[model samples]
Target chain A: MRLFRSTLTALALALPLAAPTLGLATSAHAAPYTIDNSHTSVLFKTTHLGVSPFWGRFNNVTGSFQYDAAKVDASKVQFEIDVNSVFTADKKRDDHLKSPDFFSAKQFPKITFESTSVKAGKAAGSLSVTGTLTVRGTKKTITVELAKTGEGKDPWGGERIGFEGSFVINRLDYGVSYMPEGLGKDVTIVVAVEGIKG
Target chain B: MDPILALAFGVVVPALVALAFVVVLRRPFARTARGGETDLPAPWAAGFGLAAAYGIGVGLLLGWPDLPPVDVTLVAPWAAGVAAFLGLIRDGRVRGAASGVLGLGLGVFMTGPIEDMTLRVGLIAGVTASMVALERGLARLSERLDPRGAALSQIVLVSGAALAVLFSDTASLAQATGGLAAGLGALFTLGLLWPRAAVLTRAAPAVAAILVTNLWGTTLFANGHPAVLAALTLAPLLVSFIPPLAASRRAILRIAVPAALIGIPIAAAGAFAGLRYFATEDASASEHATGPTDPTSPSAATPATPSGTPTTSGTPTTPGTSGYDPGYGY
Candidate 1:
């Protein structure tokens, strides 16, 4: 009976030590992280009249990500952006962006992204996330290079991970083609987000 | 293409194409109407030309729009097509009612999937009523006015609305509307050159449809002023009620009087739009006025998707994606 009890104690101690190894072995394993809305920003810029660069951002964005620093290839992220949340610091121009001529926010109210595949980059803590981006009811597959900013425990005892990514898309490809001359068709989208572990 | 060149391509080419179509089809269309082989009472050549021209212009500017159109802007060509088809119905009452239904559908489509039920219903109802009333008024005016007079009035009204919608801040929409005015101006010229062949009888439904749809589209979707839209809408109907002038027997007087009457409201709407535009510009001056926030401006530099080199080539390929030069690095 003593021998069996000793084995049980030994197994219990081994299990705790083996847990992290098991996690590392499973390449598909991931943890869900809710996007920290307060710390997230989705921004874009285009040229105006082919003369100067113009910038704007979406204010209301919500999404969650499945991430594992060890298994970045298995990571998946998705975002839902409220189209009406588009802001350019100018109300009239913003309104124009929301109109049918541009985003057509009324007809297609949300711009969404769902990562299809994630590949680790050559650099440490860097990844290339390939996803289908749907804007104004049109979908296009795009890849964004994401670099890990940091990961740590917050003061409130919560775990957080941050990422910054940038990608270029031709707005015309997604049918947001308005004012072809007045506004540049190619738009660069930069996304930075802090994700909280639940 | 340069912006000036592109603007010209979008405006002038479509107008010329439409004029060519009208000129080419005038003889055949007039014969068919006169023979009563076609159900339509008049040639409707200008209406058909306008619809075709607008479609071609949209194609040149935005690429041929997708089937089951993905945007409200894409719906304009289809709407113009429907208006042209409705112009074919022989019965006046049925045509007017169908125009109202078309307006209802347009309003619903323009408002899109918004959650505001009251606003949706109001837009649908307003568009329906206005289309019906405008169709009736245009039919009456078409009977009394000569072809030149009718075409002149339409050109003036549509051109004015195009300018006003431009003031409202949607350059594409204004450009599309400008194509319509250009076609009408072409039609007016055709009427002057070949009055008998370019008869505008039965063109009321199509003409009214184009006008109402564009005005409502501007007002409902593009934040255009309702009062301005209302004033423009009233202008066409008001022309129908103008009393026969003492010099109505004179050719120039006949066309000028109605065009002048239509001009009154258009001028008023334009004035209102101009004032509103300047006021907004002044109020938002701190926000950098009309243009997009310039990256090099004193304000924070916004991170943008860069398309390295600007291409005058029609294709919209970004740098790195295609062989185009990479724009500013992220």
Candidate 2:
């Protein structure tokens, strides 16, 4: 009985030591990180009349990402942007855009991006996330360059990860061809995401 | 091919078809009406030419594999075809004001397939009201005009509208309706003046009415605040009243007066087509407007998803936020 008790105590002690090895063994497993809205910014800019640059951002953005630092290729991201949340700061223009001429947000409420593949880019600490970006019911495959800025614990004791990505996409590809002169066709999207470790 | 060449190719099919129609069927329908003989080919020839060119011809070119890149929709051709077909029916058999009402209904509903049906309805209704007012004005100044002047003036007016549309935002619409309007306008201009063809020009107004509706209906901004097109529709009719006031029969004055009158509206439409653009949203003062933010600005963040999954948005504004330019509803 005493030997069994001793074995139980040693086993319990060893388990904690082995727990880190278990974590290392499963290091290939992805960490599911929820996007931290308070620290995230999603922005896009396009040329005005094909000359000067203009900017717009989606007010309501939601998405989660599965990231494996060791297996960088396995990291994946998906975003669902509320297209109706488009805020250009011009009410008339916003109404016009929300109308059929542009986004048709009522018909297509959400713009989605789901990663298809991930590859470590040639640049250090960067990943090329190729994904299908759907807008206004049209989908196109695009590669967004996501660079890791840093990862650490916060003062609130919450573990968090940081990343920023950018890509240029043609609005025409998604059939938002209204007012071509008023609104440029090529939109540059820059997303900064601070994901909290779950 | 060059633009001129494209225009040539685009119009060639309808022109040939029209030539064949006028040349081949001249004798049978060349028979005089009860009133007298005329120079215009039968009414069917003009209708066929307009429909064939703007309708089927435009359709062919638009569908062709190798054309220069252009961004446009087929709404113009489709609307023009319905107008031409209906106008032909009204001219051919379904006579009177009821037919005009029916044509207007058909024309407005045809725009249902397009975006912003409400805006389209406004354009058609405004054009209708403007045309009606012009007709009443012409009635008050009957001594100055004859059927030939009225018909030709309408032809000129519609042709101008088509020109405006051609020069406007959409290229495909320009080619399609422009080519066809030119053909019909030329046919009417020649035929109405020709003594033997006057019978063929008998119902040109009815034809122009429906055809003109398509010209505006297919446009992106068919109805703007100044209502330029409504003004264009009224210009020729208003000009017709001027000559009697001057009490002059002088041909140069007659020609110059009408030319100047028509030029004003044409220029207006052209300016909107070429110069006007919706002011970008960025022009309005916004608390967030810190001079166009860079696409790669790292201050972005998205909030958490409803599913409890974390999301990111940088400098995040609360959801359902609002701020925008209130200067214009247009």
TM-score of chain B of each: 0.79, 0.58
Angstrom error of the Cα, residue A40, model 1: value is 2.4
lDDT of 2 at A168: 88
Q: Say which candidate scores most in lDDT.
A: 1
* Candidate 1 docking band: incorrect
lDDT (10s digit) by residue, model 2, range B1-330: 245556575666655654555445455655652235443355545545555555555545444211221112334444333443443442323333433454465445444444676876775565555434433332222224443344345445555665555443334445555565555445545544552332223233334443444444434332222455556656655675565533447644543454456566766765664443222222223223442222223321111224743333223233433322222122
TM-scores for the candidates: 0.81, 0.49
Candidates' lDDT values, in order?
0.74, 0.55
* Tens-digit lDDT string for candidate 2 (A128-179): 9999999876789999889999999888898889989898887867766544
lDDT of 2 at B298: 30
True C-alpha contacts between chains kept, each model in order: 0.33, 0.14
- Clash pairs (backbone) in predicted model 1: A188-B305, B308-B326, B308-B327
- Candidates' chain A TM-scores: 0.85, 0.83
